[model samples]
Target chain A: MTAAADAPPTAALPKVRVDYLPMLLVPLLMLVALPLVGSVSTWVTLTVAALAMGMMIFLMASGLTLVFGLMDVLNFGHGVFISFGAYVSLIALGPLAGWVESDNLLLNIGVLLACILVAMLVTGGLGYAFERIVIRPVYGQHLKQILITMGGMIVAEQMIHVIWGASPIPLRLPEGLRGAIVIGDAAMEKYRVIAVVLGLTVFGIMHLVLNRTKIGLLIRAGVENAEMVEALGYRIRRLFVGVFVAGSALAGLGGVLWAFYRQTLTAGMGMEVNVLIFIVIIIGGLGSVGGCFIGALLVALVANYTGFLAPKLALGSSILLMVVILLWRPQGLYPVAKR
Target chain B: MLPNNPIHSLLSGDYPRSRVLGALLFVVLICLAFAPFLFPGSQPLNVAAKICVFIILVASYDLLLGYTGIVSFAHTMFYGIGGYGVAIAMYNFSPSWTALGVGVIVALVLAILLALLIGLFSLRVRAIFFAMITLAVASAFAILASQLNEITGGEDGRSYRIPEMLRPAFRLFDEPVMGVMINGRILTYYLIFFSALLLFLLALRVVNSPFGRVLQAIRENDFRAEALGYRVVVYRSIANCLSAGMATLAGVLMALWLRYTGPDTTLSFAIMIDILLMVVIGGMGTLYGAVLGAAIFILAQNYLQVLMGQFSGMLESAGIPLLPGLFHADRWLLWLGILFVLSVYFFPVGIVGKLRQMRK
Candidate 1:
């Protein structure tokens, strides 16, 4: 019995070491190696483009992952906040009379920063109002949440259409960042490059907030055990509102980026981008911010690949990716462990 | 509206009360059968048919959702498939008796096939998982339809030339005899209207059966029902298939009536939501609720815009275009949102559910 108890720990060991990230990184490396393949797999270009798009989606879904994972609200109306932010930022500088036109590089940077700050604030406020008035009554009930929120989504879009006609409003980017910059075979838009950078920066900030701050600690604590948090005397409902607002504001930030990147805004943009956004969040994992980030980028990369490589299968590719992910890992590639 | 909730009264062993309700329902059916003569306006008749078809849809959906407590968002996908089935049969085929039978049977079977594929992928996950899977599958089907421009006619959809229905007209005797003429707007309305009536009755019978009682039992508590040896997964799958087939029936009939088909008719979120709204508004978990809900929804929508326009003169003179402010011009989303808030808060059980409860 003693000899049996002393059985080697190495007995259960498998033949191969499973280094998962590099396994993932290999497909990614091969993806980059494609352009070198004489453009034979032109579809690879779309993958890169999709990866770029995915970055923006990741930011939106990052906040949502936390909110939905913690709170049961469907938040289908989250797309509106992004659109609203973009429009608000556009209005702040270009359309509204009180705003001064700033063509100088420093002033332009100031305006962009101001836009981000104000957009986040305004969208957060809107989220608070929505949660208080519309979402509060139907917290636990799933059906009511779905229907009521869906209606809110409809109202948000309609309001946009009413305010700005159905036509796409072209946004003016203060002179300097209009065209593409050639960077060794792949021509990249300065605006899109900025978007990718901003996305990473926000992700970093979120990690700091989640890991370092006291409120973040509470959020982590609440997400793990709600009853325990309430027992600890922290306001959980207030936390939910904060999360919803913050998540919604993140969507707004994405919208602002989308507006600048696209240099145009349309009322229908929210609805148009909705399916893709939700798909990213789902594939990324329901509750994990990091998962949403990767999922969004992954979807964008896949979409871009299909568009560049096989235009015929362009739209279907993301859906196919979603199907494969569900089959392979139903919970998503990077599900979050409890806080 | 009834005096109180029918469920409460029903629980108190008010057995005789249901018989009276049945007799009243019988009378309503007789009147509906003769409604064509009273409502002679072509517009009303056409609207009636459209309403009836939608009612059938709402009723079928309620069986899966309201009764089973599973919200199925891909009901319209089945409806779209049904449209394709009928259109394919009509276009590449004859108007022979065998052709119509083949078309109907194939549509029902194919609907079940699509439902099975969807159920296999989605049934494991409830709530958001189920909702998303259904939405994704439906959108995929819609996208596939649009992408296959040649087969699906793409965005424009397919137009079937329903050659002749000599055999069909003969069976009805008083039916619109000609093919193009019979299916022409006026006659199409009656055809759809009658078919809707038939499907609604079939739906009613199913809802009243012991199977429906089982469904309700599961809805109230799946754990308890499963504990009693009921296979929930199979039951849910069966309900989904039945709903899908019924939704297809409506879609096929509409394809026949409109003589045209488009993904917009069946693939849009609007269609799915509209069916849901109708079921809720008419009443959930009740057969008659669907019929009433559809009638109100389609009619109100058809007339409401016109009613809004009527106020144009007064508003225009007062320096407002009316639509810009109220309808929010291009965005009706605000209205939808507001109404949703109002409905959830004010009419939790929906119009039909409220009225039925009152009757009790």
Candidate 2:
């Protein structure tokens, strides 16, 4: 006992346990609170909308958090991917909207898949170029990275404004999800339900991929110590590119959902909402996948609740929560690493 | 060493004391006092006055960044806070001597308290995390201000009627040019300029003083400073607080000059970037760079637009429609970003340092 007393305390290190019980329970709690929010059917509609918004937030925050946690690079222009996806989908749906207008289901499905494919490819290419050209140069300097990325954000925004013009184009939803589903006095959009269901499915798949795959192991290891991972001769540069592309792809998917949900794709929306997304990431704990979901839901709730409580004070609540979380847990609720 | 040591020379030890500064300032002031009349009704004077105000802001920013080696993304927040303080005071109460005075005092107090809070947290973090926190807080503050419609005036931004100036027992500027009294753009410009000049002198004194030397020492080697009796964090916080106080003064002046305060004026990204450009271009970490930078920036803004207008025909002939950039319809910041990047990459010492180096 005396000899063992010389050992250093292991308490300094945080033991990570990745069972996602609390995250699962969060949604369940929301579902339970639904009746209290409104009538059962009205609750259903809001719940669906809330869940859908939550998923989009989750996807955006996940990629952002992952990159920031591992690379210590804040990708300020990340919202561009989502906008790109929306634009790509919007263009694809341009002609198909007419078909949908005529009640054609077959054309709509084709348009949806084609749009996602184009968006994924375009955004991936963009992510690849951006990673190599802009992001790679200012690797070690955070200030340079921020200034440069901010410049990129401005450039991206302007480029979008130039192409799309300064108008909010209605995102043509499929005729199938056009109107609200009436459940007694309460009505909710079907697209909102779709967004939640689709987002969750993606989340499940992402969870499996991260937990089970070989690339997942490398990524997890890389997140732990990027330099050491590189030293192990594992094509870490390629990994960085791949991760970036994947992250951008997730943002693109989010953009498609955003188009349908918001029913509009505007240039300024990317930057405006990106700030809140950043807050979500910060509060969620940078780089943690589950944390992003939790953070997104929390932010969504704050946004929703604030509007209900006092419409004038909507933005107030988000900041209030962020400040509280920051002061309480400076590293966030579940910080990725000390660095 | 020959007749003089290089270390002494390197410090740029040529000091222009009280008499020299007094004469220079007197001549400059006299020239400036008359220049408004010379300009007659030139809009450029208005622009120049605003430019001076921003110059003060950038210089204060340099105190934190270039001098102390601290990178604060939220420096503009202090400026905004000061602006808001003045706006609230004058807008709610009638604008008067008492109102502006009370506004400035309150702003200073708030700046000190905020600086203390931010500085305390700032000591616990470094680099990107620090940058993130500042940026987040700044954004949050702006958003919160926007959301608090009742007090802050929300999205449309609250406007206070120009406060009546109480006659200070006797009239000071009875028949000032471009006005019946000391108010409006030209007068506000002078007010900002003189305040900035005094503030610059104050900042210069801080840099040259023992406290300034200690700060530089800490910047160069924080561990060594810590190893000594100095509590590094406390001094850093003090410097930060001082900078914030100065910025608050600037903000109060802004509210006065603009005659209104809103989110646009208070929480403007363009303003933030402009201040940064001023610091970087003028020769950051130098006593005189802020003035040089601001002068250059304003000149560029005015002259660049003129150049573009003059070259419109040439651009048309060259089959290139003038893309005057995105800052305004007249000017743009893409050019500024390019200039900032190049300056950082190359002549990072800025105009003043470059000139000194050239002299060397």
Candidate 3:
């Protein structure tokens, strides 16, 4: 797998070939969409909106893909974490109403950061308990895992209704985050810009951590072959638990951003987004983070463009995209090796 | 092997295998058969009809999940198609027997075709992939149904008239039989009960046939089954189509009985979850479990809300904290969810499996 002969003699690094084909899909899709969109201003607005939505999705989906890659557990209840995160933010933001309404940008940002932090913490703890209780028993059995996790999802969703009163709660954006910035002819919401920035930062950190750190290396290796990593004397189980919790926390973070973007909250909102998330991960090739990011962007772009172009076909667009991609690539855009 | 009787032949030689289960099945059968006469109320009759419909739905699901070991979230999609088909046909055309026949045939054909396509496409992948793909497709279909307001009646769904024979105004006689009115509702109830019974027996026959053995073999180990030269994909796809067709029939019965076809009634994910719970709780891989599971679940769904309300009231008066909220009538599903998860972990064989195990 490694080209040792072509490697530089000085450092003796393995010459690994990275597949950049999937990486080019995001821009390629955008360029293809531009003509169909007709107007440059509308195209720019849709593209930015798509990017913001894609980032939020990536935040939620990255952890899920990682958990699946490292350990073959697809938690159907992952959406529960998203819903819980959003609700936690509701509770957290209740006391910070003043900060939310404040005229100062810093206070507004602070309130959001505080909400995100609280949500991440609460959902992360929930993830730990869920992993131990619900998922630990059916590790290798895919059927039971799907059933049990679905059961867990139903219970969690009902619990949210019991706690949240089964009504849609309205969430108002901060003073500074409201309104839009007009760039040329296109107008972009301030919150969308902030979301894009936050999503990018998170993605950047994940990229560095997964590529540069020892733990990242272990996770990658474990995803490829857990038994080999364990035979090498590493605690793959512990690593899996950590990844699961972190993935849930990321979902929570995404939930917070998604709630603010919508300015409303419902118990089923997480579930509503879950279909898109699954499509994203599948398109990206389950377990590949970079592929998931691109997949998210592709799905979001298609959704936005279709919603604007043909409102009726918007929902089916992503599924159509998945079908075409699967037919072409079979596994996904970037299939994980040995899976 | 020893006895050649009509009952055994009807059941396809698959007995209850446990006295308690056999007794339970008999009681359920009698109760459903005499529901209108014994209960003499609309509510009880409604619950019985619901049980009848669910028995078929859950049994068909067992054919895929329990027997073939395929976990699909698209079963309800086919069910919805059946409901919508009948609803739309009756809505558009005359409320005649031709409309009913046309609707049933169209729905059955559509359901089987869709099931085959999904099976052929996703069944080739891992079970997990199939599950996820079905979930995505089903959810998309739900959205489409809700969005297409003109045709589907949108979120409100369509409530249309059935044939004159099935409508409640039609009467068989001027007098009451055994203190029960001989109205069209009773006729409809009998129609559902007979159809459900026949369809359920057909499912049992399918699961007991040689084809059923191949499904079980594949479920146990696909590689070994493939080694034995049984085309695994073809068998699984056929199983998928069969299950989908049965579920569609159950939906058609439901639409006729309810006189309505709505997203909440037929296409909701909640119903899918309910089907899963019934299959797992009653017993997987056992056709008879569908009967018991559907009965228990429908009864709980109809009656447990009242019971939960009472418990919540008592807890509230006693000044308990979250206990009352947890036991509130709307939270009935929480208990079922917990029960379902526990059953999967502890009683993977479900009630039928457990009862038979006790007998052994």
**Reference-based lDDT, residue B138, model 3:** 96
Question: How many clashing pairs does model 1 include?
Answer: 22
Docking tier of model 2: it is: acceptable
lDDT tens digits, residues A26-103, model 2? 576566566556567656656666677888888766777778766778887787887877887866676556665556
Residue B182: error of model 1 in Å? 7.5
Pairs that collide, model 3 = none
Instruction: Rank candidates by lDDT, best first.
Output: 3, 2, 1
Global lDDT scores for all candidate models:
0.71, 0.71, 0.94
lDDT tens readout by residue for model 1, B119-204: 77777665576676677667777888888887778888878765354222323344534332332444455667678877876776
TM-scores of all candidate predictions against the true structure: 0.86, 0.84, 0.98
Query: Per model, how many backbone clashes are there?
Result: 22, 3, 0
Candidate 2 ranges beyond 4 A from true positions: A1-16, A19-42, A82-102, A109-113, A166-174, A184-186, A310-313, B1-38, B121-123, B161-185, B213-232, B309-331
Q: Which scores higher on TM-score, 1 or 2?
A: 1
